[model samples]
Target chain A: MLTIENLYVSINGTPLLEGINLSIGDGETVILFGPNGSGKTTLLYTIMGIGGYEVTEGRILFNDEDITHIPAYERSRKGIGMSMQRPPSIHGLKTRGLVEMCAGKRTVDVEALAKKVNLESFLDRDINLGFSGGEIKRSEILQLMAQRPKLLLFDEPESGVDVENMALVGNMARELLEGPSEPDAQHTLHDLMHERKTSGLIITHTGHILDYITADRGHVLYSGHLCCADNPKRILDHLKKYGYKECIRCLS
Target chain B: MKVDLSKYEFTGHASEKVDDLTRLDKGEKESMKMAGFDASEKNRSASFVQIDHNHAFCKSYDPGVEILPLGLALKIHEGWGDLKWKLLKPEKDEFTRLAADSTHGGYVIRVKKGAKLTAPIQSCLMMHTNKVGQNVHNIILVEEGAEAHILSGCTTTLADQTAAHIGISEFYVEKNASLTFTMIHNWGENVEVRPRSAGQVETGGIFLSNYVSLKPVKNLQMYPAITLKGAGSIARFNSVIVSTENTFMDVGNRVILDAADTRTEIISHAIASGGHIIARGHIQANCSPAKGHLECQGLLLNNGIIQAIPELDGRMEGVELSHEAAVGKIAKEELEYLMIRGMDEEEASSAIVRGFLNIDIMGLPPELKTEIDKAITESEKSMF
Candidate 1:
């Protein structure tokens, strides 16, 4: 559902994403693995239309529509939602309020969403302000659930999340990908699985996501280039055995 | 340059007495009475009844308001009933006894203990002629354990020069009472407005005042003071002002903590776009264990100027006092973030402005909050 061709992005004249190309079909979950400063976040931000990540060359197409120049909120309105690795603290704005705002609805069943993400106690608190690391991750998951976007982008969703709730985040992500299915399932699957229309591009370095969701493919981004695309479990196991040096050598 | 008052005092002069003393004189005292000055006329009788009749003026575009002459007629009637009017026919010992006391205006409104009013009482004053001067006095008395909200708005229709308005207001809050006063002024470009207001609070009473001005005026000055005279009394003042087109605005608030355990807070926010705004706030704690604080924040939208001076004085050793002032343009990072979120430049700026002023509106009534939100939206549209 999303395509990137020869995409080159830079900030302050420093190249971040160089000649990157990738595409994700409907109902596909693609995990991006890269070390720190390997253009993983830059690529996610470029896809999300955040400012300061200028596209010097190439184009990003969402459902075959060129969205290189689309604004961030417009991108959100067009069914592109992202969970930032480091979410911003918005004082005086309740977490539920922001979720409702993003959902484009007047009222929200905040309690249900909070329960889904295990954030019932913090729903009335300021948006991610004064929250612990785990709380922020949970809040991001709640927001993602509220947006219910066509294409979901998760930037380090596992980071700072507690071990116990990490499973909840993973389950929530899987449900979002699978689409809503039954009422009493405890975890409702997304309809995207049946229609094969929803997709996700998750950014991670740990490969821990393999424990929860079924990732279709994995790509290693090194020094601003997509080195390879293969089965996520296989690539992650290979990286664990050989480390990034082998990946870099293979890329060169 | 201290004058010796010991030898300057002399016996009463009979020549100062006028034959027609019974009639209330019209100028300052009459204006005060009209504005609700309630003091007995026995004190300061000479300055009480002097009417500034030459300055009387009125204007109205609507027949109802113009024909009613509510503003002018109210002033005249109030002046006629003030303590100064009684001084004209002083009754020897009785007049002397009353003279020593300060008489507030005649209109006394007392909210019963524990009574709470949800709606705001709105009062409007307007000016229509050039070279016209006005003086008015108002008094409000809130009884023990009561709560009240008062809204006063002023506007001028005339564009003529030399239009002036002088207003005075006094408020009294008994123990455990709470009072909120909101004032909004939108005057013509050439009008000069001066308002002096004071409030006294008894034990456990709370007083909150918010003053907002959105129009460009030739000159505007006001000093609103609150005195926490009872233990556990609390007072808070919040003000916002916007000056444009070479206009000038001078506004401030003074908070005095006179009783032990009293507390006061003052906050002022000003925005200047091609004009000048000067704001000052002072908090004084005179009794032990009293606490006072003053904060002033100013934003310069254009090349215009803004000055804020905040002061705090604590005379008692155990009292606490603090002051803070900040002046700058909107933060660039915040602006860009909002802009990236679909808001244009003007919208971003106004959003921040609205956020800055929304601090106090949280306690306002829903209807008033909606009105302010609409006003901010309209102003944002105009800027765009």
Candidate 2:
């Protein structure tokens, strides 16, 4: 459902992502593994059409629509949603208010949705203000659920979360990527192992997200390039045994 | 009392609205509505709707409280041929004398001992006639162990009417009494207001003053003072002002702690859009074992100007006082963050401005707090 062909991104005239080619088919989920500063975030932001991530030379298509030059908000309106790793705090905007906006035209039971993620108490509070790591992650997931975007982007969902919170985050991410389920529908890891007509591009370095949602493919992004694409288990095993240094060697 | 009006001269000080005392205009009720006053309410009423020195209506709701016209209150409280500016006797300057000398009529509110009045005594003072000076003297007296709440609103009916309002209010909170006074001003663009008020809190008494001015006024200058005269008295001032479209406003609050173990706090939030506002907050701790704190915050939109001056003086050995003041525009990071949440630039800016004005002042009645919040939100919507 999402495709990036020969995407080259620059920030302030400095090349960040160079000639990256990636695609995730309909109902397919992909895992992107990269080390620190390997342009993983740049790729997600470029796809979401955020400012300052200038696409020097590339084309981005979602559902066969060329969205290479669309603005960020328009992209959001066109069913593109992202969960940032470190989203900034909005001083006065309440968490529930943002969720309501994201659920535009959709009669969403926001209170129940927040309660499912144990975020009901925080709905009235300022968005991301003084929230813990686990709380922020939960808040982001709650917003994404409210958005119900056709193509979802997840950035380091497992980072800075505890074991219990990681379980919660992983389960929620799996259900969202699985398809539209009833508000009361309960899905286990086995249910998410089988994919449906919902696509996602997840960025992770530790491969812990694989514990809940089984990805269809995994690609190694090194030095702003998609080095290789292979089976998800093979890539995780390779990274666990040899680390990203092997990927760099392969690139050279 | 003769007021020397040498230094207090302005351009239109020559002509004053003569006492024609025209009947109440329909537009007067509309102006009252703009100031958030409803005439149909029965429990708490606008004891006096004085329109440019005319006593429109007056009433008292309960036996524990007394609301009377200024003329009748003066004659009754002072007896015949007695000079009884007892509580609000003019002192210090010619401005007080001017208010005392040129004032036509005002309202008198009194709460008897041990009376806990839940409903707020509402007062609406409006200006309808053009080129008129509405000068009045108000007195609020709360006897020992009494508790009361007063809501006063001031507004002008016509947008082009050039009027001046000078009011002097004196309050007395007896021992163990508490009084909460809230004043909301919705003035016209060409109106000028000068309100001078002072209160004395006796032992174990509490006095709270909340002021909100939202609409555009030609000029407004007010300095309200409260003296904690008895031991363990407390005083607090919570003010929110929005200056828009080239209006000039200078407002201040002063608290004097004259007895031992007294406490005081002053909080002022000012938002200026193309206008100028200067907020001066002062606290003087004259007795031992007293504490005071002053906080002032200003948000400037566009080319508006704001100056915050917080002064603290501790004369005794055991007095502790602290103050903090900040003035700036909204943070860029906050703006971008809200934009990412699907709010446009204007929506995000208005949200921040409204939040900046929404300060949490302690010990306000829930209904009053809600009213203030609604007013702030409405003002924000109509500002741009």
Candidate 3:
């Protein structure tokens, strides 16, 4: 669903991401683990086509179409959506109205959807204004659900959320990637596979998200390089024991 | 600032009286309706209509409220002298001087003591003749334990006809009384306006003022102040002004928290599209346990300019006063946030501007609310 070849990103002539090649197949969800200032966010933003992240030398393809030169808004129109970690607060723009806009041509029952996230009372309020950490995450998930994009990018969904909110956000994130389903018993890693589903690229630092949902693969971004395409649990276990330096020294 | 007193003819514009406002012609009625005056007087307890320098219509439908012309009220009520030009002195400026000397027709609206009139009283000051200078004095009194609302609309008869309006209004909120005054200005592009207004609130009284001006005007300058003189009194001011192309506006508000436990607040939103606007607010807390807050925000859509001045003055150590002022274009982050939601740049900017102008006031009539929404929509069309 997504492809990148030799992605070289720079900000005002300062090199940020260099010589990066990554691909996520249809119905595949890739987990990216990176330390602070490891170009993880730069990679996601470059994929989303945000300003200030100039692509000096690279080509980004989604569904076999080159979208490297498209604007951020055009990328959104082309079924690419992002859940930013720290979204800006837009005063006077109600959250419900934005959710409806995110739906596009699709009709959405906003009140019913807001009830799923316990945001029924916050529909009329300005989006992201004075929202708590958990509320912000849930609001982001709610927007993505309404948008129903084919390719979803999650940037640190576990940050700033408590355990209770984490459970809710994780389940919601799962439902967004895989189509919605009725309440059922917990699924093991064996039941995580699907023939065709929404594609996702999630950025994580703690890897606590691995306990909630299944990931196709886990890769570490170190010094602007992708390394160690292995099982999600094995990579997390190795990072917990040996840290990222071992992966950089051997896995690359 | 360059208004010539001799250029406008103050006399010979005395309009004939009309007992029923519905009898007026279609054009005049439409213009007045745009200024928030309902010719049929629907949802209004009382009304006063003044054309040029004449009192065309004045009446009261509710027994609890009294509607009288300023000239007649002064002749009958001897105590009018004490209330006239009491809060704002006539020697302060040329506009006040003209209003005091040539005092034409204005309204004297008074709510009886202990009376609570749920419906608002309406007043329309119209410039029907060419280059007419309308100088008027208005007084509003909400007696003890009374609650009242007054909606005043000021406008010119035609879009391009030149006119000038110099008005002096004094308000008094008695003990335990509540008064909400809403003013809407739909002036012409060639009109100049100078309004001198001041109010005083007594013990346990509440005074809320809302001013909205959406139409174009050549020049406008006003700074209305309200003083909380007694303990437990509260005052709030909300204003939304748009300076369209070729217009210049210098508007502000001042609130004084004088006694212990008194509170006051001022909030204003100004938009400049190919025009200039200077938005100012000042809050002064004099006594201990007093609180005052002021917020002024301005949005510049084009090459137009905006200047926001918010001042805070604390007379004593125990008083709390704060202010916030911001003047700039829209934030890029906010725009991108909307764009990601499938809105283009133009649609996103329009939504932001509309929201910026949507200020919530206490007692806004439905008609006025619709007018404001229409005004915002109309202005946004020209902006993009």
Candidate 4:
């Protein structure tokens, strides 16, 4: 569903990411492990078409459509959604209203959805205004639930959440990647198992999210290059045994 | 500089009084509506409607309220003569001099003691003559333990009318009383407006002022001052202005906290969309235990100028005074965040502007709040 071939990205004429080739097929979820300032967010922002992230070489193909140079809004309209690590707090823009906007033409019961995340009181509050770290993460999941994009880019879903809220965010991330716990009448149980097609590229550090959602494939992003391709849990175990420095041998 | 009053006629376009405001033509009523007047009169306890140089209508429906024109109030009430120009000096400026020289028609509204009316009193000063020089002097008195709100709308009846309006207003809130004055201005493109106003609050009194001007005015300037003369008195000024092409405005408010425990807050939101605006705010605390704050923020949509001047002064050692002022365009991160939520550039910008000028914090009644919302929407059309 998504493809980045030899992606070379930079900001302010300084190269931050180079020779990055990655793809997430339909119905596939990928977990990326990287150290801080290792061009992890730069890659995600470049994929999302955010400004100031200049794609110097190569291109990004989403469902075979060339969207490397398109604007961020256009990418959002083309079934790409991103949960920023630290999104700006827009004054006067209510969380409920923004969730509804994310749904576009589709109708969304905002209050009902907000209740699922225990964010009923935050629905009327300004977006991310004075929100705690856990509240922001839950709000991100709530917005993504409304967006219903084919491919989701979650940046550190468990970063700021407490151990109590981590379960909610992780399980919600699973629901976003896979279908809900129960399928609707339109899809049979057999169809649900085979036809579900939402994809994801989640960034996580501790791999504690693995306790809730199962990741199909994992890769360590070391020095802007994807290396150490293996099972997500095995990669997590390897990184725990020896930090990101040991993964540099895989680059050689 | 003195206004060239000779360029406009002060008389000869006499208009007859209308018993009912709804009987007016659609365009005239629309012009008044844009300025926050309610033609239906459903949400008002009393009303005062004036055409150019005529107090066409002035009446009070609630028995607890009394309304009278300036001419009648000065003659009938024995102590009202001492109230005129009491808070504001007639020689303060040329505009005040003109208003004092010929009081075309202004109203004096007084709420009786211990009366708290649910509905507001609406007053519309509409100028219809082509080049009429309209002048008015208004006064409001809230007795002890009484509470009242006044919604005043001033406008020219024509979109391109070349007229001039000069208004002088003085309000007095007695001990333990509450008074809220909300003024909306929708003058035409060629219209020049000058409003001079001042107020005083007694012991334990509360004074709240809300000013909104979203339409075009060639030249406009006003700076109303309120003095808290008694202990525990409080005052706040909330102003939102949107100036478009060919418009120029110099508007602000000043509050003086002279008594112990008195507090004041002055906040203004100014937006310049290809026009020039000078937004000013000042607060002074002269006694211990007094507190005051001033905030003036400006947003520039395009090629225009926005000057925000906020001043705070403290006289006594125990007094607290502070201020914050900023003038710039919308933050880039704020715009991009909205755009990625599925809205295009224009839609995102409009949302930001509406939020920047949001009036939900002003505590306006439902009727006047709807008027300000409509004005914000209309002003958005000129921005893009």
- Give the CA lDDT, 0 to 100, for residue B2 in model 2: 26
What is the C-alpha lDDT profile of model 4 across B1-384, one tens digit per residue?
246888988777667988888898898888888887888888688999888997888889898799998889888999998999889887887778877777787899999999998888889998998999988889899999999988899989876899999988998999999998889898878998889988999999999998889988988988899999999999988888889998999999999898999999898888999989998888888898999888888899878799888878788899988888888888878777776777778888998888778887767777767877888898899888
Q: Which DockQ values do the candidates obtain, in the order shown?
A: 0.18, 0.32, 0.60, 0.68
Error of 2 at A17 (Å): 4.3
What would the per-residue lDDT of candidate 1 be over residues A1-252, giving only the tens digit for each residue?
899999999999999888999999877899999888999988988888875689999999998999998777677767787777776554345666566655665466768988887888887676667887778877877877777788988888789878887887777877777665454445434433455456899987777767888889999998898988899888888888887898778887
lDDT of 4 by residue, A1-252 (tens): 999999898889988888988989998889999999888888888888775788889999999999999888888898888888898887677898889988989999999888988999999888999998899999988998898888899899888899999999888888888877677888778877786688989899999888988788998888877787789999898888889778777677
DockQ of 4: 0.68
**Residue A118 in model 4: lDDT:** 91
Model 1 has an lDDT value of: 0.66
* TM-score sort, best first: 4, 3, 2, 1
Decreasing DockQ order of the candidates: 4, 3, 2, 1
Q: In terms of TM-score, how similar is model 2 to the real structure?
A: 0.81
The superposed Cα distance between candidate 3 and the true structure at residue B74, in angstroms, equals 2.0
* Model 1, span B149-211: residue lDDT tens: 655555554444446565556687889999887776666576766666677899999998887
How large a fraction of the reference contact set does each model reproduce? 0.10, 0.27, 0.54, 0.63
Q: Residue B168 error for model 3, in Å?
A: 1.0
Q: List the residue pairs that clash in candidate 2.
A: none
lDDT of 3 at A41: 90
How do the residues A113-193 of candidate 2 rate in per-residue lDDT, one tens digit apiece?
999899999998888989988899999999988888778889999889999999999999987888544333576555644
What RMSD, rounded to one decimal, does every model reach? 10.9, 5.4, 2.7, 2.0
Model 2 residue A218 CA deviation in Å? 4.6
